[model samples]
Target: MSFIGIKKNITQKDTAEKYIGDVSTYISNNYSNNIKVHDIAKYVNITGAYLFRLFKEYLHTSPQQFLINFRMEKACELLKDCNFTTGQLARSIGYRDVLLFSKIFKKSFGISPSDYRKQL
Candidate 1:
């Protein structure tokens, strides 16, 4: 008889949870650009692959997605009070391309940065 079983590994969801918390803390405390998946895994004592799997399994998203969302959310907050152009805003949020930032910002917020600021 042949049987199939699921792989058993990394059962402690708490580790992944801790990693998420640590990653968030690191992003908040350090520059947004510094929060890479490798750095996050190193900070949480996990391999990059393991951390990626953990985030996908529990959060249903990749670490990059989380970081991008976090950055965009912060940018939205700053947009309300700051008068920086889109290029400046992109740089402030660790985005190297103003065009790319605008595309992402528009997709996430349903408006470009300029439009968002005008609403504020």
Candidate 2:
């Protein structure tokens, strides 16, 4: 490839990386709120479909999956500290339904939230 083509490729890659970072940061900062792929795409100034493709290309995961994993990881940290009830944790992590939160948590960590807390 020509130097100009190489430069364009590098710039595009950088932009893609920035978009991924922006999306990840937004999710981390707003995980307590109801976030959608559309919302994230808007925040990053891209269409939802494009954002999905970018995530798949760069992170090998869907946006929704990334959000789920992020929330679950946060839940694990909060559980370790023992600062909140399951319901509170659920709500704080953007899950209005405690049961749903528990289900996802168990699926991710191989233990219920209460059981995980107990182990901690």
Candidate 3:
């Protein structure tokens, strides 16, 4: 009785789950770039639909929402520096348009970036 086949099956399952971490690392490293779900899926060699389902199953959110959360968190960290202008902060987190960044930031934290910085 050999257990090698069972171990191989477990290894394959682990490899499948590895894609989630891979996608997260890719997002973290390149969150500054204008990356889309498709880009992330391509990195994991999966379809965008599969990536979405994977995220939903594992992380309880879609990739797009996860990206938004990541960007907003980065914005919070950058907001700690009072010297950074809104436009600069926006660009740092892959948002080219300051207004859109402000909108999303406000939506996420219920405060404008400037006001958030002021609180800090």
| Candidate that scores best on lDDT | 2
lDDT of 1 by residue, 53-79 (tens): 978998999987887898898898889
**Looking at model 3, which ten-residue stretch has the lowest summed lDDT?**
8-17
Residue 58, candidate 2: C-alpha displacement in angstroms: 0.9
Candidate 1: where is the Cα deviation over 4 Å? 1-11
**Candidate 2, residue 90: lDDT:** 98
Clashing pairs in 1: none
Q: What is the Cα-based lDDT of residue 40 in candidate 1?
A: 73
Error of 3 at 37 (Å): 1.1
Q: Candidate 2 clashing pairs?
A: none
lDDT of 3: 0.89
RMSD (CA, Å), each prediction = 4.5, 1.1, 3.0
Q: Which 10 successive residues of model 2 have the least lDDT summed?
A: 74-83
How many steric clashes between backbone atoms does each model show? 0, 0, 0
Off by over 4 Å in 3: 1-13
Deviation from native of the Cα of residue 86 in model 2, angstroms: 0.9
